[model samples]
Target chain A: MGTITVEKANELFWLGRYAERVYTTLREFFIGFDRMIEAEEAYIEYCKIVDVPNVYESKREFLEKYPFDTENPDSILSNLYRAYDNALVLRDEIHTETLSYIQLSIYDMKKARVSIAPLIEMQKVIDNLLAFWGSVDDKVDEEKTRSIIKLGRRVERIDLYLRFRMSCDKLKTEKNKLEKRIVRTGLKYDESKLCELSSMIDSGEILLNQAIALIESLVEV
Target chain B: MEQLYKQSEVVNDLLARYGVKFGIYKNGNFKEQLFPFDAIPRVITKEEFNYLERGLSQRVRALNCFLKDIYAEKKIVKDGVLPEEFLYASSGYLAECESIMPPKGIYSHISGIDLVQSKDGTWYVLEDNLRVPSGASYPMIARELCRRSSPGTFMENKVCDNRNYASLLKQVMDYSNTGGINVIMTPGRYNAAYFEHSYLAEKTGSVLVCGSDLFVEGDHLYYRDYTGKKIQVGAVYRRISDEYLDPMTFKEESVIGVPNIMKVYKKGNVALINAPGNGIADDKGIYYFVPKMIQYYLGEESVLNNASTYLPFYQKDMEYVLENFDKLVIKDVAEAGGYGVVFGSSFTKEKKEDFIELLKREPRRFIAQEVIDFIDIDIMEGDQQVPRKADLRAFVLTGEDTYVWKSGLTRFSRNPDSFIVNSSQGGGFKDTWVLSQ
Candidate 1:
């Protein structure tokens, strides 16, 4: 690399974050959407949770359009496309096969409406993308580039929170010297132990049961 | 009966298998989108290819001479062929590069020369992309996959093999090396053309690096590995633009640029591909004078003819552009990638008047050219094979010798009615097949 222009650095960080966010959020949305099925005023409740306007006229509309509509321009599919585009530009920084995983995932994400099977058909894409991220982590060695990528994921996670207004549920956000920023998803944890917890969290480790217990501890507040 | 459509299915499948794509910003969000490949090969006959090779070579050499002179002696300006005001006023003109020489003293090591053929069969120069031009890998990779899809297509045709492009690029980098490893420097992943950056690096066996991987210490460029081993970079085929090449020298606040890399490049410790300050020679206004530069420098007539162009910097050309605003295309000198190109026919009468007044006020910002009704190539859309307007971007590598890649990138408009086929404009590309015969 000759020089990292400020514009490129911003793109690199976003590419990593958006790719990860798309993988994680898509997984989270599937779970969150499933839960809304039995809730009161389900569609409206979920809309408020995601913080997006309740544009859908019905539950069916939300299911079909919430994630796939290109017109929304901020849909799950759209964000994934954005992530992949950034990844495409940053291909040299990340592994080739890793990028291929993201490419296959977005390709699969676009056809979310076509499958007669279920959202389960997309599990492969999700798994492949997760593996891709892990490979990228193992392969890319430069700190400046890697830190910027991590920073990208951090920013994306923060934005995903702000966009969906998802109850500050995924990670722990704190006030930094200049602004509110993310540190991690727990209440003080070891960095070396994070890989294990992150994998668990990705596999639905921190769920409503965990949410309830954490809330039980803070009920007085 | 429908070979092009069949080719696309094959190309698309290959793209999926090997992976080739880029990013685009739509609705304020970035998206990684596959650069849809059309299977129909843009075929150029051996005679036409020879003509193009000669013209493009001449144009490149003349531009090279222009760069050498602009920085060293300003001979063309002294000869009264090119105006001094145009050089100083245009955005592509960089005075900072004056008196500074790059490795091997070749300004444009790789030139992505865009060209279009008219319905009547005349070729016109569309633009000269001398600044970190891309699309080489797009065709290079697409060809590899396309051949896998239809092996018979190659066996039956006389198409020129474009597989030597990477070797040519490698040779160019090696030829200019000051003494260390060759590195392919990409801005990072997420750049619009990041796939090409990495793919080319892999193909050429050069180490891929991001800006942060490189730093200049006391006029020596180094790529620091994660293990803290500093590898000296003798040459860098950087894919970033000149404005972002150095923060300390140009945009001090730019975080992606190295602080003192320019100092090191100037010190001659490292070779920069498509060196900075080269934009002056490729400027739209300067483009018109390339043929003249060839005649003056090499004492030979230009092998290529530029699309009939008018520089409003001259009174006569300004009058013609004003009168023919409805028939010509206006271009902003500083704008690139189809961003600044405006077609006269597409503008409303009111808009045409506004543009005329704008051109009068800032003629330096614009140049006008005759619209080349470029030829169309077939692309498969569903079951039908349709002809869409397309142009060719020929890649010429300059090292020990000037060699045009046997094949070039054939980008076509995906929009049914559009003429612009740049990746930035949502244009997908096809592979160009040049027959050896």
Candidate 2:
């Protein structure tokens, strides 16, 4: 076995982030989709919450395009493709069975044509992503590799939770996981900035803009 | 075999699920295409496999000896067994590799020798791929999937288990290891054979690295890891071509090459699998001399025969080629992967005349071969079994000893009338079953 190079580390980190981004956003898309069926403009609010441009004319259009659009950089398919691109290079470190989940998700997203059917079809995507995480934890033997990937996953989850306005407690749990992985991986980070972000989150004085900035700046991997 | 054919669709689905694909560039855009797998395997009886084993081993050993001799003593050239002009005129003969002996004195550690069986049951060697030969993983993984699809078929048949190709590969790498970790160096994921590179690395417990992941420092090759730790690389199974291996030595424009890697290799600090400059032996022009090489180096009759070949470089052979222009297949020595091959019968009268003129003007640039009427194998086309042109690529590994993998890659052309069966030429592959009894 070879030591993970800095370039590989960056890829692993981004792989985790993109995989989690697809999973979390797909779940969020389901909720937005259900609401969009009742109101045509509900998806615009959802796009605003996720910080993506509300390019679609209506909620129905957003539901039709967001999950499978290749052109939209923030679409579920794009994130899944990015996840696959990153995982493809790390096959030596990541088990194939684990990587297969991401591949299946990409395939499912591409095959999905009926707009509403994909909202339910994405359940397989969710299952695969969860299985992918479990496989990473169980199958990956390298400490640094697992830690680096988990760090990316947790950081992306925290960013998504904050943007989607999940409970502060949930955000805290995700942040705590990220912090542990950061320490375990021994990746360089701004320790003071991390502590300041934690204090602001704990004290309930955190501005959304400032917290997002701090989270983005926490790790440079 | 019937059960395997019945379950072909399911097996193909599984292959796609596992992402068994090869990438190709079309109009300068990269596209990954699934390498279709045919359920009906090409069965080789134990007796036939034994013959192939000996022939492939003997042929590869002679080629290795030829490489070592040409690089060191030039004895074959001096003894008049091989012409000095042929040795020097070939572009594959790297001058920089002169007098530098690789670890274990092995040049072609892994050889993929392409062969075709004629209708008369005679096996003829078609080409020798000594440099970064691929397609072993295709059959290796195909067998895995096939066995899973029909366990009863495998149980009923006394076929040699080919799952040990990974272990065999590991052994070769281990035998060639001079010091540190073994690594499979790739240009990147975009290369045509990137899947094989990564799959072999995963199976052999070697690191799969790109050029930037590796560097040479103080006469040793090292792999830089994510945490900024450097691991020394003892042996490298580099998948890139010779000209793109080391930027400082060969192609200076290659961004995929590790600088000064040849320096580390030259100093004997690291082992390069199928050591560089092996293209000299695999060159199409040099192929005409392999049987002679076996006779000269091993002092034995060649077990395998080269396809009936005529070198245009020789005056008598050139005359024969000219007379038999409409029946022979002419090949450019510089090209491979089923390229640069022209069947004389397929050409127009004017085109044939033009090709003959080119051959006459530059006799050293081409070789002509009698078109062998190779046997066709049955492959499932929809629900019907059809015969298609196919060829086997037998892999020979040289380590502490020379060993030929029992099973080989059987690639068949999908087009019924097409003779070319390279994957790059839209051919699909079948599992080669070498029966134990």
Candidate 3:
């Protein structure tokens, strides 16, 4: 692989973050969606957990708009579009085959928006996302490129896990993974913040807002 | 062939999946649209390919010679073969590039020569795209997907592989490199040919960069890596136009342009592929003088024929254009990509008079050509075969030698009544196949 410019490195980092954001949120939406089928206003709690505004008024509105609305920047479709935007520019770094999976994911997201049975199409979106990551690992030969994206993926996954209030074991596993991955990326980060997050994770008591803030600012492009 | 045609949708789906798209600005809004692909390949026989190979190489070589001479001595203009007015009035001609020879004395390294075949089977050169010619990636990628769709179709036929466009491109850059690395510079992802730029960079193993990623220091163009280490760039295949390449040299207001890069180029510290000031060679007005340029420079008759073109700047040609106003197509020399083009026959009487007045006032700004009835190729429209006008854009790569890629881009108008086949004008493309047998 040739030299990676600062601009391309920034794009690679965001591509990883956005792809993981779509994948994790889609999964969370699925779980909340099932709960909504039995209890109409379950999406209210779902919004609070995901830290997005409760813009939808009714169960039908949430079901129809939360996953598909492009105007809402927090929607699954919007995040998927962001992932596509980042991946589109990183074609040389990620390779075309890996980039195609993101393109395919966007297509599936669009198809899901109109379908009566949208889960089938959304499932395909998740499958393509998985394939995108797998292709990145298999085809992206540049160790730094792979590590940067992996760093982004690790950061985003831990952020989402903290938001969902997952178990202490889950947090430690992801936190450890992030600590190992960040060093390999060759990107500059605030080491003190990462150490602070480690202490928080090790203490078995985490402040949600402070931890998410630390993770967001840990890496510098 | 039938097998390939039947799998058109599958192939198209793959194109979309891979984001094989071109961006266009519609009403000041940028939209990336899928360039529709017709599965039926445009096959050229080995004999025909060989003929085109010779003619295209000859034409590109002459154009390169013309570029070298026009900037150095203006010999052709002095010898009365080409008028000085055409050279000076051309918007493509840059005074900044005068007398500064490129690294290899090569201009127009990768030329996209557009051609159309008449119904009578004679091919006519339509235009020469010397500066930033694109669409090679469309056919190259399409060929890959076509083979994937119908491997049996390819196995049964003897088609020359066109997948070596990257290596050919690499050779062009490598041969032109002064010392260090090769990079493909793009304006941004929003540009129409961004897909080609990035894909070619990936294929050629060159770093893809934008203007902000590069800087000039001590008479050298350097690419700054993420680590803040500066790597010297010996050659840059810049996809942006000349005017937007160096803000200090061309368009000072252009934020996308690298400052002082032209200073590096002028000093022979770096090479710019297809070199700046190349637009002067491919100017629509200069295109009328290419055959004469071939004779004047090479002392040989042009191997290819240009369309019957007339410059209204000349008295005799002006009279001929005025007399046959309805039979010619008028084009603005400054415009491109199907814009500023008017079919004379389509004009009303009042519009014709108004245009004639404008033509007489700015005769040097326009050229007239006899509208040839080009041959049509069948394209699939909902399982039905329909004929549409098409033109071929053949790529010629000049490195140690001038090479014509065996395959070309065959673009056809989607509209039944239209002659314009620009992707921006809603045209579809077919993969051009050069038959080995």
Candidate 4:
């Protein structure tokens, strides 16, 4: 019932972004993992797509260490922890039932090893994230806070989709949702940059490097 | 109750799902661990609870009056009921809090009075926790899950619902509130009792805030929202200790405290739950004088007895403690959460002599007590039920009137040999059920 603080808004937005990142990246990691089983260089491509430095010595090392590694700042576990850290602070805005999903995801991530069984176990992370977002929409009554978090989620999703070379149509839909949330939140952003990004997204002549730069600069808050 | 015990795993799983945990620093790293819940409820008969409620209420009232008198007239000291030297020498007595009356003349709006029952079934007050007492939410949420797990069990029993603790807390806040919204101020999520801080805020419908979320402007406390909207704060149920409450007043290096907020509290523009400087009354050394305080302030004999305690500051007690060093439990007055406690018998002869030397060197810093042979409650460990040392922390709330919550947090040591039952000491909790009958 209280207005979200600037610090809290930042946390909620990043909570959405990091949780979405973990969800999307873990799903994508499986695809890359399957390919890596066939050819080890498939991980290099995956690293390039996510823009994380290839730190592991071999594909086996990457598969074994990447998902659960706390040292790797861009690992799914790290992202999940970030999401939890952000969500923990926003317990007032987010319902306990909703926050519990994030907590469960983190707990499962800790339990998950580099074993083949965990590849299937990772689906629970995605399931929990979906449940988390659903619970947020239903349980969080504050429209602005929800919109801000959704905006963060949409932005992160669009960024990941573009980088991962997902379908253009999916990117456009997500970008459109992001645009609407950006407007709904009423937070300040570069209107011209958003329009420019929109034009580039629409023309399909969008250079990945240039588009990533524009997306990064799109929202300041 | 048997049905509930059978569903212990289910209740614990639900607790895990709800993030029911407490944070602790282990090996210099902050870790959050589940405060394990035992299925067996600590059931208190209605008659026993009635007696406890009255006694707890009276004790807390006397403590509150003592705080008021200490800050204002010092009548009890002047009347020779309590020594002035003992009052001023206490580390908990804040000079800045003198003559400052809290809203509605209430101090310690929430009091966690720890009591242990002897084998003979007579209860004795172990200690008073007037400063930032926690653990209420543990039992409160546990009861919620227990009822859900076995609805028929609850229906069959005459248990008084403990779900109203939050509402009762809210009522106290509202009663003592000068104006505006109630806020629960936590140090942060890293603090030991962070779960309780956030849970109580959600239950009471108060804004849960850290020190950074609040600021003092124009001598009134205000909470800043994400949208940069400033809302005036009426009551603050701060979970941080007094020393870290206001950096400007107590600890200047405390970054977790809001600067000038104590100014606001002093001005009566905002109400602070369990007003600042309450530690003076709850200090272990001062605990020896509580019964005297009851008689001095309330003009009535204490219904509950204190664990036979001896303050080393008194020459007679010091001599007695030195002579009986091997039989008493020596406690450092300033420490809490089961720390700074030493069983004299556990110390070697050399160590006992060293401790005796330290006690003589700083007599005021310690107190010795005849350790009560406290009663144990049954806890379901795996398939077997075992008796473990447990203690009740009965919460007493004072606002317009002093009242005790019928249900309390019953914490027990997981180790069969340990007497310490603090959550920080790797203890677990059980839901306390006060029979409505």
Candidate 5:
């Protein structure tokens, strides 16, 4: 129940979004990387399913640019940078020990960038991101702060799950978690939109775009 | 000590892992760089530290008295101990702060005094930084990691634990609280010392906030939380400068400053640590009279030495400065961070003449001092230990009384030829150990 300003709330919310973005995207990138070995143009299907622009000209270009290119807004490195941008400002709330894992993730990403065996290096990046979330859960003592971050995490996972056309059961589980966590955050949110999104998931045939829009605009921070 | 030095890389890697860095701006782009750590500490014996503790306390006390006098009675100026021109001409002097009594009448709650030791073992005060002094956290955190890196070095040595800085700081803020919560207001995360600001806030248990997070209402300042709940803030360890602290009172164009917060401060509703208008006491031109200030206010001789400084505004000092122009170092009064400092000997004949002409034209803008060839400390370079120039910034916290921390920040030049040890100028830092024995 510690006091957090509107600005800090915004940072915490986006910190959740960006950290989740980097985590879910990195996990997706690994799967895509495996597919690219057998099928060189497998990333095009990833771009289509994930709703990102296919900017890579070839399999070689996709492998080099997908996770490492900072210029590409959809790249994993860009998402990690965004996560760092939000976490850097929230050091007082997140605590340094919690934030250092994010710092380590960036360093791991930089190592992956110049790294000869990048996929091997990227495995550490994923490990650091996982450690970051574990630290966030263990170190952040305040209930409201923890709840907001979890809400953002749950919202993002659902968005990505919807984009990947995940199972109705998987989407419902994330939706149930978000519904339970949102009430604990003390943040202003569109409660009606949450209910509507929940009903759409329960219907078992979700309109993916409308559900993504609902989750993005759910929080008023 | 050898054990600690052997593990320097491990300690540095831990520092980098913990995000121990400072931000710097170059070509309009901001980048954060690790503040390089030198494992070799500058050790001060108990007796030496006792002497420094007394001297630093006296100097800070006199400076505080001068700030009170400058804003109120002008007794130091009236008594002829300090010149009036130096008081008014100082860019730090604020006309708006006249007769505004801060909470508990404490002007400088925290003072960072820069000091250097000459080859002859004589210590001289280089500068007094009263406004938003940083680098305390650098040493504090380094000490923590150093002990973790080599606990035996601390066990074998009698080095005092320097981790009480946060408690000391909390005491200052709590002592000055006007009946509400404490907060550390920063410009944002892009500031050069943002790491220190956030770290201190975490350590001291104060909320770290930017300008937009706070507001003034009915002569009181309040912090608005995310849920729109208003919490009154009693003490603010503000890291922003005076001009950017209150947009209504200072620069009208500053978006990073709270509007009319000064009105709340003036009303004695909240305390601003190292209260506004302290720049007047720490001005370089006013530094010439610090010895006289100690004599006038405390009726005691200054235990610390001011590095044989001469102001060209005085007829006698001007003649001596002109005669010994090439042997002295000239510093611009308005600039800091090692920017406006120059060695007279480094100037060419034509450039020296032009500089002398400029100095003569604007005598009040600069102060000339005899260069103190300070002693060099050993820092590990590659494999061999080499001597490098270093300076110590001793932090003094004034609350119910003046208390100087036993440990300080010891910064050294990474380049062997340079004397500028500012972090912004590519300098590295070491922990200062005051031996308990």
Candidate 6:
């Protein structure tokens, strides 16, 4: 089992990505939906943040089609589904109850209805998902695997902050977790290069080359 | 507030946390779904359970005798209680298990007897599952969760503590084991009863194994550990059917079966819990003859009652089945888990005629049962309580001794009108309480 078939390794990688995708996206969407409630033509600002078209005929359509829709692979519901599916096959590798919590949370999320109830109640779902992800970080036997998942979580956090134009303070916390996760995963990078990229993003002027350099530095390892 | 009787949201909450669940396949993807929990315990008084225990054990004891007779002496056939052709033609009859007596000479070490109580409180045995049956773990765990959710509920009532299921299971496996480790072999995480398999393994302290974890080398079955270490396996409570057991012996291409394990088994290096060829004992066709086997072999009258079964193999029984085709429940001898069962009353006239024609052509394939007016159990439908059809799967363990776990899994259909109580059919399960009194 430790031979780690390439397919299972890929599943592990995707499981990390998908779990983070659902988690970060839901948090981002909730914030935008709140802001759009008071802004002029709420869809424009929200769409700008999420990097999607505000093209729905109305705000109602956008709300209906977003968050929990499975038909949309980009939706929170679909991503969680994929995460759980991946975790299902990896039960022998991870803690059983850890996988169970992921499945339980996703199952509960799938039943969310189209009401204002989702807006207020979505936080509990987020907390459960975060708890599920946290349990994996805490309970996984291989600290390297936890580091890898945190890598995925950090990357997704970066994606959310860059895409949603969130305050840097929020991104800062995620970045710190990601940095701590990196220590355990054993990824190498030049300190000077990371400083340069952070400053560029802070100045709202992300250099694709510098970012690519940082990402490639880890991969080439 | 008092917990509502019947199926309720309250009970479902308890079931989910304890991992009371079943597996299903949708769009070719395997998923484990929580079987809905009905809050109402299918309450059986101490006296009633005693009667059931007597009958079920009697029925199983007879089945064991018949299994031995069919595999060895064929005395039942010679004695004219059973026909040779009937035993030979049976799909459950396995030539591989010929003349092989399991450890302790026990076959059907664990029996899952399905029963339905009628309005009059009389219970009728619907079928016998001598092969691996699930749901025992569901109610066992559910009871723990429920008692914690409401301590007073059990205090005010007399209910049997079914938590000893794991101990009973352990004893059965240990008694039947040749000498090594007790392993619960599961197909994988996707099999419909994976939860039960894993849960039982944890509770019984048996190692949970997949097909890949086992291999036969030099006529011995061995379990491969994570670090490439191999340990001899003394006993295996295989959850998979006998057909997929040793691919080399049965289905050669089965990726889920261990190769050459039969060689080890035949050499008596390890013991298979419930043993192979159990289909012969649990087969629906063989069910009709249990009472006869009891009388012929055990020298005792049947303690439990069947559902008035009419096997089509006999010309006289076939005629009777044809005449009552619209009133009887026809079951395919090979089907289990409520599959291949058809209620005559539910069929169209043309369908009934078609079934009759099929029965006439292959009389050995079916047995028609007179439908009893079985009582309905209540389940929660949102906030309202509704009556739904349900059945109990009671686990009786035969070790160096015979014992029954007090708790049994009670499965009920989610649909109010459906008689099917299979988890694969979207049914939910409840914890059964056999009162300690």
Which candidate would rank higher by lDDT, 5 or 6?
Answer: 5
Q: What is the TM-score of chain A alone in each candidate?
A: 0.69, 0.96, 0.98, 0.96, 0.96, 0.77
State the TM-score for model 6: 0.78
Clashes of each: 20, 4, 0, 5, 0, 3
- List native contact recovery per candidate, as a fraction of 1: 0.19, 0.74, 0.74, 0.58, 0.75, 0.04
lDDT of 3 by residue, A58-85 (tens): 9899999998888999999899889889
Off by over 4 Å in 3: none
- A1-221: candidate 2 lDDT, tens digit per residue: 53777888888899989998998998888787778778867777888899999888866677778777889888888889999999988888886777878887777776665534775568888988998999899878888888889989988898888899888788888877777779987677889878988987787676888888888888877
Of 4 and 6, the candidate ranking higher by TM-score: 4
Root-mean-square deviation of every model? 8.5, 1.2, 0.9, 1.6, 1.1, 5.5
> TM-scores for chain B, in order?
0.97, 0.99, 0.99, 0.98, 0.99, 0.96
lDDT of 1 by residue, B1-437 (tens): 24435667767866874577687888988877778888888888999999999988888887888888888899888889888887898777777788889988888999999998899898888889898889998888887877777787778787777888989999999999998989887777668887788888766768777777788887699876533468788999988878888987776767767778888888888889988988887788888887788899888987777899999978999999878888998898878888889898889889888888898899878889988878888888887878899999999889878888889999999987888898888888988988788
True contacts kept of 6: 0.04
Better of 3 and 5 by DockQ: 3
Q: Candidate 5 residues B1-437, lDDT tens each?
A: 89999888888998999889999999999999999999999999999999999999999999999899999999998998888899899999999999999999999999999999999999999999998889999999999999999999999999988999999999999999998899999998899999999999888989999898899999899999988889999999999999999989999999998999999999999999979999998899998899999999999999999999999999899899989988999999999899999998999999999999999999999999999999999999877799999999999999998999989999999999999999999999999999999
Candidate 6 lDDT over A156-204, as tens digits, reads: 6666665665666766666566666666654444566556656765565
Off by over 4 Å in 4: none
For residues B231-264, what per-residue lDDT tens digits would candidate 6 score against the true structure? Answer: 8888999999888998888987788888987778
Candidate 2 lDDT over residue span B320-391, tens digit each: 998888899989999999999999899998888888889889898898999999999999988999999999
By descending lDDT, how would the candidates be arranged? 3, 5, 4, 2, 1, 6
The number of the candidate with the highest lDDT is: 3
Flag clash pairs in model 4.
Answer: A4-B225, A4-B226, A5-B225, A5-B226, A6-B226
lDDT of each: 0.75, 0.89, 0.93, 0.89, 0.91, 0.75
Error of 4 at B13 (Å): 2.1
Q: How would you order the candidates by DockQ, starting with the best? A: 3, 2, 5, 4, 1, 6
**Per-residue C-alpha lDDT of model 1 across residues A1-221, encoded as one tens digit per residue:** 42333444556666766776777677767776677667635867767765668888878778778878778865777778787777765555565666777777866776666775447756766886777768667866655665566655554554454445344345444112102112311122233333433343345444543333332232110
Clashing pairs in 3: none
